[model samples]
Target: MALCTPLTNACKRATASVPSASATSVLKPCSSRWRRGNATVAPPVTQDATSSKGPTAMVFMNMGGPSTTDEVGDFLSRLFADADLIPLGRLQSYVGPLIARRRTPKIQKQYAEIGGGSPIRKWSEYQAAQMCMILDKTSPETAPHKPYVAFRYADPLTEEMYGKLIEDGFGAGKGGRAVAFTQYPQYSCSTTGSSLNELWKWRNRLEGKRATGEVDPEGSIKWSVIDRWPIHSGLVEASAQNIEKTLATYPKGRRDNVVLLFSAHSLPMSVVNRGDPYPAEVAATVYAVMQRLGMKHQYRLVWQSQVGPQPWLGAQTSDTVESLIKKGQTDLILIPIAFTSDHIETLYELDKEIIGEAEQEGVRRVESLNGNPVFIKALADIAKAHLQSGSACSPQMTLRCPGCVSERCLAQKEFFAGQAKHLSAFSQ
Candidate 1:
């Protein structure tokens, strides 16, 4: 989950793209060509007794970043232009590019601070490798679980992965199914929703190709998703392990003075009003991690990664840091609960900007969770568990928002309309 930052006014909401209805209406009646298309009928591919007819193309989905500094504008362009992010309707094509071009210089500086580009692709690829290794060992029945990275706005985009899957004979029974294993543990319409929607678009387009009698080379295409896993036991355990390890780094005496804070990307109130369940599910991850650590002193949860001047979830991290300073509490341990790896948001935003605030306030110590081995292992376990289970998603991993009332949940998907609900109204 990435945030629009001040360096770029990427958070400015454009008028909602689809008319007369919320984003939900655009997704309705489940009209994607992927779902409407026919399954490829092909000669049977022999499979070992333990193997499922096809290999698993597991793509770790994320909002990709530039590999080089110059490409940052391209990254920002795709991000700002996304209907999920800015919703500019027809004007998106015009203004979104302008927004990206305008923000480039400032955003470039931020990327430069973190070594020229986001390491998200690097980290996500490593995680995918680890997941493939685990899946190979633990679930031989689904052996040959080929791992790939799918970014919504950056390189190795979903469409790229889709073409590769079909080429490799994974489409429709060449013994392959695509798995969009979300990198988000907690669901959000902005993040996971955007990723899923894009993937669906690819499927819908592929449906057209098949209609032209372009047979799926090896097998029928199928999709399985592991979108929200906020409370997966493996994930909680890994987080607890990292928290325990990182906390010990602080002076023992100062440890008790420090607050264990969980920071997440913030969403606009308008997005939340549309029934985004991000904040609440994020809270669930924090609470679960807190429990695993067995902390008696209350921990904290705060939102970060806001951009532009629009309303966002709060107490904003900077504001929260200031409040803590005012209370004469400076020692802090920040766990980026929404991110699985260290990228711009963590390496620069939280580590520098936000922590710099604490330092300026005379806060003695601060730290963030970044690619802990345990966390990676837990992620592998989560994805592996999903594949071993027959359902599109593991039942245990579902974290639907409380009182989720979107018709799109049933209309567009059994899983994807899938964020925002049951939290206190947006406020600081």
Candidate 2:
């Protein structure tokens, strides 16, 4: 894969800036900032990469991590600086950098504990490939489902992926659609908001055929989004099934005695106060999973991945474990509810750090879901369902995000209009 970075004024312009030059002409020689490489001019993309019978590109969006220890600081910097993540307004420019710098050492230590980097990119690649294969088989009408990934904070960033897809004639030709499929199971202004906003910014730059102020042009990229599906049947079934297998880790006769702890990544109360629906959506996932499991065992939803001195959603996972242990309940299983793969949070925070803390309090075990096939398939199914009908967004889609009481969610309803504009009906 050729790695390229923006070096021209065209790259800096917002989506609808009419260019005297074509998009291909604006994209020039690869800069060294993308990777360690010689200055090499990329070949111009032809106008005929799309076929009416073939499928559109299916792009999976997620928060990425550094591939190695050396990239950790940059990754953290990018993550914190994003207005979508921290949303500190004008203060973000200063505060985001300061936070990233201040937290690097500790964050690096956490990454180091988890084998010196994040497995996120690798898992995302595997998941994308698997999803393409599944779609190819399950929905022959949408053949040749090209899979791409756009990580918000790391390599293969959303803009980079968008450039590649555009260069390939995606979203600019007949039947040339682009799908922004989010990997985040639940939606929040923080996670899905950031990713979609980045994508839309790119789409605005390449405003389909609508750019020339013409009718929806023939080859312009028709866009759709798969934002959130926290309670999808496939997803809920996968989590429950995985937990069922995890229950076996305990004594056979005492399976009912073990407590199930569903964990979600914590956001600041400040963010929640701003009306982020993350906590409610996370609870929805937990409720659906527990319903599917139908276990007599008790389960509770707890929050993890908290940073800074500020308050976050609770009961905190660690505090919950301590309380449970004090009540003479030592056996525990920690299932990361909001995560799709085992990153530093799952590997270090949930499994090692939390489990270590629990064992100190006489807790027996702590288990995590590490890219379970069932879960991966659930993700694939979510993507497929959206592909079959390209309209699963925040406000109103297949799920009940309409019931979101978050003022932010209510205010952000208009943002998902493009998703509604180009919905693909299910193909036989």
Candidate 3:
């Protein structure tokens, strides 16, 4: 029962502060002395019309995968170069590309099986649109104001999309716009944090070159960002429903015997040591799902898609399956909680390595919950709530929050600055 504040609760507190007073006062005192006096009263702050309209920009943040085998090398190079993603020194320069190239063949095979491309980006787009539709139905006013847009960490929607959005008049200065980060299910430093960092960097770049010809010289856009809604109970319940649907397809009486294996993307130990709550946040999601289902069966949380020699978060999925085999657990159901859609990790790693290992260990049945309808609906619900609330998704606003002090905050600030420098170097 380790306690961690949920994202929704944090947003409520963060946005609940008293509205700032304006210079024009709504009330005029009737006293002659007051009338004669030059004292001025502050006016009430007016809320943005779009704020009532709903979230203006529903930005889907994800670790984009390479579309073609040729792009794999460059993709890995960028991924490895990201200090936030790898945390390894210059070793990533060699190891990153090396591993990516070596795995390219197998990864290519998996993509072929799953229709010659990774579905993550497409599914992300689908999820974003679905969420927009749901929000529109649930909260029509806000829905039209908030349109869905997709951004990727390693692909086309790079920092450039930020400028494009502004140019398209979806930014802050053009009109008081509301934006929400839609990384479904849960958040991780390597994924959500990386995406947000890119957004902030783009914003900084836009602001810095507002007058110069170096970048888009659009009107100054002020952004109110709602980021990182880690785990939503609605989403958890939806995941449970997906699990139930998958389990139902299996033969009866094999249900209770099937071990539920919740999988998330693994990160290096350095990340957790530095105070990233990704692991804990994932575990909480699993707990919520199981609780919603009222299941008494034993479930295990395992890490997947581990790379490099460095220590990654565990128990690794492969090892977990082996241990389960020793305990005579034959049937297993893997729920990829870390990802809301099918991608390289899901199509290649878990479906290949873990499934192969399970077969070798004499496991008979292997069930999986893909990005099904329930899961999509759950995401929609979470996004709708976020739009209505007008709050950032991540718990504690990893960005500078007033009156909060910790070494982690200082480190994040330093990291933010460092990333800016790196991007500047790249641009130059």
Q: Write the per-residue lDDT of candidate 2 for residues 1-428, one digit (tens) a residue.
A: 00000000000101121212122121222232321121232332222233233465678888887777788778877887776565556787898788777767767676666677776677677667666667666755655566778998888888788767755545433235566788887887778877876776555555432243434444456667777888998778777777777677667877788888887777767778766777888899999888887757888998776665677778888789878888888878777788776566666665566676566533433333334567657766776676655454544432324334444433334445644665544232
Q: Which residue pairs does candidate 2 place in steric collision?
A: 15-204, 15-205, 171-221, 172-219, 173-219
User: In terms of lDDT, which candidate is strongest?
Assistant: 1
Number of backbone-clashing residue pairs for each candidate, in the order shown:
16, 5, 11
Q: In model 2, where is the ten-residue run with the lowest total lDDT?
A: 1-10
- Candidate 2 TM-score, C-alpha based: 0.79
lDDT of 1: 0.65
Kindly indicate the candidate among 2 and 3 with the higher TM-score. 2
Model 3: per-residue Cα lDDT over 78-108, one tens digit each = 6655666766666867765666566556555
Using Cα atoms with residue i matched to residue i, what is each candidate's TM-score against the true structure? Answer: 0.81, 0.79, 0.73
Give the Cα lDDT of each candidate.
0.65, 0.63, 0.53
Cα lDDT for residue 193, candidate 2: 74
